[model samples]
Target: MSPLASLTTILTFISVVCAATSWTTTPFNPAAIPLAVRSPYLSAWLAQGAGNALNDVWPTFWTGAIVGWAGFINVDGESYVFLGDPDVPNASFQKAVQKSFEFTSTQSVFVLSAGPVDLTATFLSPVEPSDLANQSFPFSYLALSAASNDGQPHAVQVYTDISAEWVSGDDSLTVNWTTTVGDTITHQVQLEDQTVFGEVNDRIQQGSAFHSTLNSTGTTFQTGQDVVVRAQFIQNGVLANTQDTDFRAVSDDWPVFALAHDLGTISAASDPVIFSIGHVRDPAVEYLIANDATQNRSLFFWSQISTLDDAITTFLQDFPNALARADAFDAQVNADASQISSNYAGLVALSIRQGFGAIEITLSKDASGQFNTSDIMAFLKEISSDGNVNTVDVIFPTWPLLLYTNPAIGKYLLIPLFAYQATGQYPNAWAVHDMGASYPKALGHNDGNDEPMPLEESGNMVIMTLSHFQRTGDNSIITTYFDLLDQWTQFLITDALIPENQISTDDFAGSLANQTNLAIKGIVGIKAMAEIASIVGDTARSSNYSSISASYVPQWQQFATSSDGKHLTLSYGNDSSWGLSYNMFADVLLNTSVFPASVYDMQTAWYETVVNEFGVPLDTRHTYTKSDWQSWTAALVTSTTVRDIFINSVFKYAADEENSQPLGDWYETLNGDVEGFKARPVVGGHLALLALQAVRTQTAMPAV
Candidate 1:
């Protein structure tokens, strides 16, 4: 048996039982646990490693910047820290012993022992792919429940706070905050001087951070310095319900918004205390349309709800239903993915939140300054890598998850790219690289000075467009973009067969001429255009593309295949070189038999021989590999053994103890170390296996 198989078997019998603390971590332990990741700015995580228990480490943004979120509980008048490390000087509070940690698609649950009482802290970020209102909301839920562990009743009070670090990434920035007492207690924190659409280290500098909980008899609110407020709760079990008048820099004294729930006496059952944490930014994105003008776009939730208070209250009230929906969604993903392998299921579960976290669904405003609900658009920030907006290559990798969850989301993501180019603002003959250089500002590159990935992006657009059409059966996208699509196809015909020394999607590996994988992508793209043409009743163009793609395949196989006939070359003439042909996944997904099955078999067999401890390398160039492309390549294999080899490798990397960052798509294959990227939406491609399975299970193909 393989190492992964042995590890899986060992994990079945592994459970740590001790007198002080009994621990049970199910499935596997991730490098970092996602705490409350909603949108790009609302993301938070807890790094997992030595001395990194829940109480020992602070929650961090995706960029690894500390976001002060702390939680403490008073058991029988004795304070214990359960959530974050506040590093209070000479504090008397003891740390809770974490008993278990488990994560699903939408929640990260941790059970900790605070004295004789056991606390379950659940961080839930709902993934409602079909519900635009809920999905667009930036808030995430934190539900805490306590029960007696030794059959003895104990008095408990739960305290949690959000520090001013959340308002801005820069520590020196001055922050001001307010506390409102209404149906719910809310503490709103923001920068004293807001810079709209500005970002510091990938954290928004203009948004207001709201920390709220429902107003109840036993609940009290407070806002003060982090050390002072937490020290108050540590000594006394309740806050003073006081607000600090002094507003200063985030790091000066470290201001915090706090709420405490006093459970008089806990026996067998205690009511759960729920809190909502989020960031609200008006005019979420600066979008460009066909008129060569830029307009501010508000988040889609704003159109559904008028005020921030309403959005928070509705979210807090809907916790039970939201939890149920998230549980169902998690079960469905696990059930579907386990059909292949448990490792694949774990990967799918981890990918869901990180995948959805990179996008924002926004509605454009009308002439009257009200959000136009009908004029909805979605934009994605290519996190960790240049922060490009609506990057074509980036979207290509991420579409599998969107397509699997809701096909309409895939259409929404494509609209911005299409709308920007249709205005004749882009000067390139092929597709544009991305909508903007920076996120939230999707100003089209009218100067046509965007990065040139002409062949890579053009093929990616055609393939993704056809895949979306196949799933949705909405030919309107094809009919509307036919002229541009035809133009891209023409560019493919001239440059695909002998690809110039231009970079592929793996631009980090540098440029190459006649890449075997690039050639296959272009060929499949041509075939995809044929399908698109046929859908629109353009038979002449369809036939032309079909014949061109068919003619190029034989030549591609001849030039790209190695002399040993074992694997494909990295470039056309370098027979000694080999690379992953992940582009073959499009052919499998679209069912476009452009390449023969023998090619799949050959590549599958060859991959097993070159596999490392983590997974197969991207190419002969480096030992590092992209998890997304690995999954895409895994979907191409015909054998279950080879497919599991790929799946298990990526799962091992995710569970690597040394890796403390959010799920990174690029990592070293030998030691399972992160190569460059982190918290990227491209991890959505990890669902390639399930996406292909969904495609195969369709009873009938949509008619054009």
Candidate 2:
């Protein structure tokens, strides 16, 4: 069924059918607690588990930067802390128990019971694809609903506060405040001489955060270096099922700039490369007038509003429907996960949420002033680790989720590479490995002393581009970039069969001469190009590439196969060692005849033997495994039993108590311990099975 129709059915019978999911076995520990994950920049999560302690550790960015802390609740003149620090206990409150922690596609609800009162704090950052106005809106809603559990009338009050540390990288920034005519308050906190996307540096950029409260008493002050905004309310003589205050937090990097005009391109010897004039926006002003509709842009994120009376009023007025949509989306995701397996339902739920949460969409205005979420003029991938578009290799794992959500987004992701190249970003024959700019900037390839992974990235780009075409059945995208694809294919034709020792995507594992697995990638890429050529009616070119790819299959099988036939060697002319020849598995996934089914069976059987307690290693070269690539290899297995063995193993790793970070992509296979690269968007790679399923069933991909 269509997602909308399925959601409608769920909403119709929700009360009767929807049962609350308890997450005690895999409790809501703070390895990942997504509170506000609207974009890469607006994302917030808890670093430490706050199960029973209301006053827990401060919430932080994926970079481990502190965003701030919020806590405290009062009932009838007695106080209780439910969010941050609870050591200074309150008289009227015993320790609150987190009864249930539930998540949807667009919302998270935490059920907490304190004394006789039951509270549901629903955190909503509506990501409804059907409503651009709500999706692009920067603000997140912290809606609190309270009721009497003991069936007695009582006066109740609650308080939540955020530190000014949220606005800028430096907590010393001066903050100014304003109170709207309505029941609202706004704080404009920012650093001095703000520059958005100026230099490509690794330090987190300083920006503005507008904190506002709706229908509640608000206060702002400086407590040491922290700027604190507190919103508290009292419902006199409260009855059961009463709604209290709602808090809104909106953040943006204003003076946003992007390359608008194409700079003329020349050669590698050309001195002093230049950039064209760009667009600069005042995010604060834009926030005030986002609803005007007269100032529309084609940018990814075009919505932001201050605590002005009209802005707060509109948000509150439209919140009911927005929230309803979020609940419906949640129900749909939950229902879908349940169908997979009760053991894996939560794992799937968290995976889907974390996958989509890593991307950031910025806004841009067009000539017509019509807000265009469709154009996605600026699709930014935040380098929570290194702040580079760090394209090709990094985006390889993320392709599965993007393909399953919208194949168009897969095309959109490639646009930046083309855009950077058009402006002479990199002077390479194949695809650019990584755009040099640090996080929040997409200027160009900026790694000063980095070596380009010609084979790794080129193979990745071609394979992903072809996968996008297969899912979308869109021939135009391939045609538009045919020249680029042809150039890369020709490069692969030359170097794929006999690769020189060079840095690959897995550079940490060091270089390898005649890398066998990488050769498979090039082979798969060539075959994909042939398929694309046929789709675009280039019969002669298709025939030429088909023969080229076909020749490599047997050559690779002969050289890469271990003498015992138990595994494939990691490199050519070496039969003792084996690694993930994951790229070759694509032939089976694409239903192509390039690689024989025996190749896949042999690799799968060998991997099962090597499986550790956590997962199969990335290769025989290292004990560390990548969750994303592991998923790709696991999807290649034909048997459901074999596939579940791998999937559940990874699921257990995700639920492990020690690996306490947001989905670490790299980890030790034996102990399920994180090695490095934490909280990355590559976690989306775990959804590769979804792409395989979509292709097999010919089902419409889910809208993320």
Candidate 3:
């Protein structure tokens, strides 16, 4: 071959590589993307629509606090931004290409090109629920990999930044950061002043610091108001070559009190920090390279006699296996959901992430010593402090996921509430609405009122208890709380048949007297108690409660059912008004036979007519709807066609931009806009219907 021809061929190959890697400036509009979804404190998400601007909309803690921004890609002498703002145009991007994005339960990958170099940034958190170590890890991995799409050589560099706000409760505090370089580069940042932990609402933690490290050779770590990390990608190799880095973010004194509540000042100096870290592998690396790499790349040994290093070392070694479990979980959920309907599948996928993601398993221990065993008597945080654990109403919506996914995990949620009641902290004859105490600080009922929900909460407790028993076929949990359930069920027997003005779960819509739906819940709760009684061999109580429940059904129907029989009146003695007695679906779910199957048919038909373009209104009182309840109602329809109609209506409502704010449990059905509440775990309520269907169909669900 002629020398001139060889030179031309090589140049052509390089240009093609550059063209493929060249960045395409595409519009960014994601409803929301999950990142680092380990717990309430560790959970983070990136709101879409920022469009090539990383800092445009800062990453948010599930609580809605801005954690920081961490996305940027630079190649050779040119800069093309894959994440955040691109301040400078890169020669790399002079010729544009395409960008692609992929998201899964545990990972999100973004691929962008700048000239001949292709860059892919992956955000991964190992959230296998069965693996306590991986699920409890505080760190998420941010991996950056680069390669030459074409066949020629190219140069590349990448940078990422995180703000000091991550560790600061407020900007008024002085910010200071220090840098340490060993085999890896680490940057630690914190506020100069620290405070002890206390019980408070909407409170952010203080007295904590974050340690972020870049795990790579030739890494540069810089700190200011925001810390930045840069790494060398490639020098002079085939543009087809690759380079990337492993990044870790850890907060010392996490859970600031360590769930110990020692009472001595809960400052960093006094309390032990919760230790957790994550590990990741680059796909670009071959098995030989990975196998030969240092096994203990990111372990931190702070104490002379501590085995923190070994613990982390073992975890990092087993990281890949944990990730495999996470993958299987995602696949099973995705497949199971798809069988219901496309919209149902989408809802389930998002619901699983948003609903389960909001819960934080704060601590795990048993009857043994504090650090004795790994058996997790774990407590889940409600994300919003106001809706803390065992908020019966809140748990009502969030039950399906736990019940269907892992009944054992569901038991963990209720055990704490039962323990609190057993302590006599809750001395009420009737069930309280919540375990009392705002998140992470459950001493007793903290709603600051006596029996706030009265009928509503009592009914919720009895009904969910029955549900737990049905799902697991284990009466131990029900038997353990039998007396309490009996008392609550007895309360329902008195006040529920014809409810007085009292708050229900839909308290935001205001209290209503003689609420027909609340009455239905009462009847259902009584029936549920009957089932639990039967489970525990209390045949006499079971028969008596069953008869009482049966009698109430006719009385309720006489007053609450519309004369036309098309829909139920919103309240008793108000035949002209209407609302969703979605509670009726429970009768169908429990196969209780108290309400005839024809009743479900009648309500399903009625709901179809009441549905607007967005969805069916919750009741005649307003055009607003609760998404979770809507899902339950939709799932009640026996006909697939009718069920799909309701599912699509709510799906469209959720897809609307106005309702695009992190799956609000409550929204206006008229315009598909959020009325209130977002990022709440109650979306798990949507899973109730799915769980029922799963059992009826005898379908296998993901084994937690």
The best candidate by lDDT is 1
Which digits, one per residue and each the tens of the lDDT, describe model 3 over residues 1-704?
Answer: 33234334333432332122123321112356666565444556766532322334566665566665444434445544454432222122232233665555566666666576766666666555554444444466555566776766555555555555565445444545554444334444545554433222333344233433323333444443121121221121111111112221223211110000011211111111111222111110111112222111111111111333343444444445655676787677767767786556656666666666655443332234133232233444555536464577777778777665665556656765665565555657777666544544444553336447888778877777777677667777687788888988888899878999987888877888999999988999899899989988999999999999998888888888888888789987777788877787677777777787777778777765666656678888888888888778776776665566566666655544332246677778667677767777788877766678665764545544
Kindly list the per-residue Cα lDDT of model 1 for residues 597-635, writing each as its tens digit. Answer: 899999998887888877889999999999999999888
Show where candidate 2 strays beyond 4 Å: 1-30, 49-54, 86-95, 129-134, 177-184, 198-206, 216-299, 303-316, 337-339, 363-375, 423-425, 446-451, 701-704
User: What value does the lDDT take at residue 651 in candidate 1?
Assistant: 84
Best-to-worst lDDT order: 1, 2, 3
- In the order shown, the candidates' Cα RMSDs to the true structure are 3.0, 12.7, 14.0
Model 3 residue 534 lDDT score: 91
Off by over 4 Å in 1: 1-22, 699-704
**TM-score of candidate 3 versus the correct structure, residues matched by position:** 0.79
Clashing pairs in 1: none
Give per-residue lDDT, candidate 1, residue 598.
93
**lDDT (CA) per prediction:** 0.87, 0.57, 0.57
State how far residue 522 of model 3 sits from its true place (Å). 1.3
Residue 265 accuracy (lDDT) in model 2: 23
* Better by lDDT, candidate 3 or 1: 1
